[model samples]
Target: MKAKILIVLGLLLLNFGLQAKEKECIKLHVGHNEVPENLIEKKKSITHTHHLSGHEPVHIENHFGDVKVRVWEKPEVKVNIEITANAPSEKKVQAFLEIVKIHSEKVNGEIHFKTDLQCLASAFENNINGGDDKEERNFLRVDYEVWMPEGHDLTVENSHGDVYIPRFLSVLNLHQNYGNLFADHLKNERSVIDLNFGKGFIKSMKGGQLNARQTALLIDKAENVVMTNTSGNVKVLMADHVDMKTSYGSGHIDKVSESCRFQVKYAKEFILGEIMADVDKLEIESSHTNLELPLCVKGRYDLSTNTRNTDLVLKDQPKVHYITTGNDAEKRMLIGTTTETNATKVRVTSSYGRVEVK
Candidate 1:
């Protein structure tokens, strides 16, 4: 009878030991990474290189915080995770890691996690985008610092964290609904950035051949540029081959060396700084705004403008078709200089603003 009791107690202790073994704790050094210049005073970015053992599906998710992940090839696939944090204390970091352990799960294999003395929530503010006026910021703030090899497929999502990467080459798709995301440049094309902003700002690519889309886009001296925006200040300088679209913002294009294309729907005003290129097509819908364009193009162009101001002018005949849609005051504005030969087609439509060829 005593032997049976002893055996039962041993099995119970074994079960508790196995359960504890499944939960592991890790610590990281706090002086390894660089936070932003402004954030360095208030917060810090900590880098960590963690490892995972065996095949376990590792899931790390943060609600309103920054997150970064990297995978590398070392005979066996090692998951090295790096985190930049604005956490306050070592004790808080330990507590936050415990919270992370409760939520972190191993799907592919077992993970040996390592992090810094600060909590992950210290990296960014944890304010949800809308309708969350009653909750406190109990989650951790984590600014992300991720680096992977050439072919790691990763997906990152956040609520109030801005995504910033200095350099990395991996298949990455990211979206930030309420913060400004910035990437200096991609070293190679293996890295793909898919980003969105809610009320914050977004600055994706500076120069070089980049494929970028923004709710409110901004560009300065880009080679091949494509910009779309709702209502934000946009500036373009001496460059070429730009395809642009806007709803209710001003566009300034100057000294473009090649043929450019622009489609503006509802802008309060329009400004063409200097059009020194042969335009392929400058199709504009000036609903209740002003219009301006250069006199010539290399090939064909579809020029259309609707203005309230009746004194409109076109100094040359367009090579393609000149289609006008508006009142008689809009039609009488297409005045030309030459008795006319081969010129790019110019179309005019006026409802409420002036049109000019400058």
Candidate 2:
């Protein structure tokens, strides 16, 4: 009986051993010829030069990279692209390089450059299923440095990177996301900037319109500016003839030379450091806002408000004459004139907020 029991036990142990050996063999077979878990980095750089008439428009579109543009005297466009890829193996790096490329062509007398990542859906799927979840997937990025002739119109669309233009003297249009814009000495007549979730700094802007959401913008000097902001902030050191609208945002203008118009709504705040005496008009309309502006002793302003818990404070000046009308429960209006003729019209209308003119 003891000899029979020992034989049965030996058979069970051998079966268990065989099962474990089979599992080990299967694991090794599955992992055979697979790429190692080590990371590999590769970089590629390419440059292109395109002849232009110096009057054609240039458009650039990119994703996940920085773009730097500068003006040059040559009547041509020069583009330099640097591509970086990180993968677990040389095969993956080559795959990324084959899919990620920059395509440039001429369309209707315009030069167009675009970053092409072919079939993003398939690429993502392949990367996800390539290896363990804890391993790093293939990553790629491209950075652009472009030089174009002066006087040519420029448009840039980018995401997840910064756009820098040191000096652009022609029509410029920029649309960016999750990045910052740094432009200095921009002299476009009809420039447009649409930014989201970023910050913009402009040293000087001649004429432009800005649409910002969840962003902050600072302009050292601006003229003929039009801006609309949501949940953001804008500050201008010197402005000439600005039309601005804000929602859940704040703005500060250090000085206004010609005219200014601001429409604020939904918990916005604005502050005007100074209004020139020769400013033709200043108009402000607010709902649930807090606004403050310095009163020009030699300028005329018209103020009106209809509100609940709104206070209008005005500073007294000998040269200015103030006329008040209406009741607090209904509508309140105040008009101030520094001179009987050519009075700088200042109008303020608010509801559920405060206005201070000092």
Candidate 3:
């Protein structure tokens, strides 16, 4: 019986060892490759050649190797090519370069080619099943740099690297898998960013203007702005705008303007210290609990609580609208107005705390 048990244990260990070997991978090559200059500069010797390219723009979609490109002012738009090798042969590097050259020569609209990292997700019967020498199943890194004729627009798809754009570029639509994205000025109306979970902590350190989505929207020095996070807080500076419908976290207190619609919805996260409802219209909603509004409201005040508590501090305003406060139970507050005998809008309820609106 002991011999039989030992044999079974040895077979199990062998099977597990084979599975472990299947998970390991060889060297993973990533980053950009630079193009040679001789093939581009020496041949196009017509007149002044700088960065002014009246020539057509270059476009590419790389799948294997790094891509480094530089657009120059030249006749008969020439393209330089380079690639990196990762296996037993240096021939792959040369072969890829030659293919890029040929493709550039034939294609229209300047040149369109790519030499970046690609995945074998479609080739395998099961993407999760891979040998030890295989790359990671979830991520594939393709690094490249393409130089356009200054005013050209760039569109990248599912990339994982830094995107660099000059100040006066037309529009930059960037999407990343796992990296930081940087662009100079977003002066154009089309300069919009759609980001997915890859750490889009952005700043316009060197640019004329910046524009992000409404979720990350905040006025620099002009109009009021509002931003809401699906799973985080919205931070705005002083002389900024109103915020609404955000989950988990707080907003900055110093900034409040009339141009923005600012309010916070009920959340599991905490909102500490004065939630300044300084806007014209202040609206708040909390369920299953009570909320405290520390500032006075001037515009049409609409407050609703379904089985919750609401507390407000009314300001001394001449023209105030109907204050609608709802509750399935009792709520608490310290309310004092200009004239306690005659106030504009006041409603109260209770499940636990005292109600005061005067």
Candidate 4:
């Protein structure tokens, strides 16, 4: 009996191993390649820290690599930078490092820090001005980890890589391209962020107003939000007022306290969650997309659909009074609802798309 049990256990283990290998093999077939370790060189690092006497804004701009900024209670600031260059040979790495300069200066109580890429910029300018058309064959990556005092303002900009900030209580201006951004907590009156192409996630952000533009955004809590995007997805859990404009994207917000407004230019899917009667207005306009709303509406609504179908699914035990109208000759439909005490007004317009309510 012991020998039989051992054989069965060995077969099971072998089957599991084969399944894991098969999964990995499938991943490889789908454009996943494993590169050898010796092809890339190790990163070079430079670190520095400083103490400041005044509370002025600090600015950091990097070309390529990640940037992380944090806040602490101490009265000092610390910075750590990592640099990596990719080339065919070690001589090229040394030559590239000689041209790039890392500069940090304190001017009038403000700290300015950056990795200046003047050499490449000059090369590009020369190439554009009828000079040698030889392209730049080298690239530099600089990553930063910085910690500053709490309540200190910051202005950070990067071209490529992720940007992360744990907590901040002052003004913030962050811009980036082709990387993700994350913020844990924010306690500012207003903050501005713009990204060319990347995803952004914010949690527990409490502010009077916020303006964010990116490819994709996900937020847990926010207030007075204004966002614009070209093509991506947006999800919000709880917010007071949201105004959004998207060319091609989808949105889902769980709860809106005051108002929700969206202007979509192309095919986009928008979904809404619970809505209170205290909300003044809810307006949505889409060109060729589907819009879904909750079934239980507490106040009043006015919805219209053009060249498409409209579906309204009511609850088993309904409370509000609903009135609907349609013009079959013009292929247009209108729906309206009302409440007793707190009246909410919702207006939606769609062209060549469906409007679903449930």
lDDT of the candidates, in the order given: 0.41, 0.72, 0.34, 0.62
Candidate 1 vs candidate 3, lDDT winner: 1
Deviation from native of the Cα of residue 264 in model 1, angstroms: 2.4
For model 2, the local distance difference test gives 0.72
Q: Which candidate achieves the best lDDT against the true structure?
A: 2
State which candidate has the highest TM-score.
2
Candidate 1 residue-wise lDDT, 30-70, digit = tens: 22232323222223333343343333323233333445544
Q: Give the candidates in order of lDDT, highest first.
A: 2, 4, 1, 3
lDDT of 3 by residue, 50-71 (tens): 1324544445454332333344
Per-model TM values vs. the true structure: 0.51, 0.78, 0.46, 0.72
- Residues 1-358, candidate 4: write the lDDT tens digits: 0000000111122232233333211100000122233333436777767676767778888765688997777787778888765434465445444545678888778888888744444333323221211132334567899989976788889765788988787888888776778888776767777776777888966653444454678889767667676777778888677777776778887887777787776646877887766787777777677777774345344433343444434333254354445564222222234433345556676666666665
lDDT of 2 by residue, 1-358 (tens): 0000000111222232233333221100010122236657778888888899848999999877789997778889999998776566675555555656688999999899998865343333322232233244445667899998788899999887789998888889999987889988888668998999889998988888888999898989888878898999989998888788888988888988888888988746789898877887778888898988776555455544455677877665553454456564443333355334665666677778897777
Please give the distance, in angstroms, between residue 154's alpha carbon in candidate 2 and its true position after superposition: 1.1
Q: Where is model 2 more than 4 Å wrong at Cα?
A: 1-38, 119-138, 297-309, 315-321, 324-343
Q: Candidate 1: lDDT of 284?
A: 48
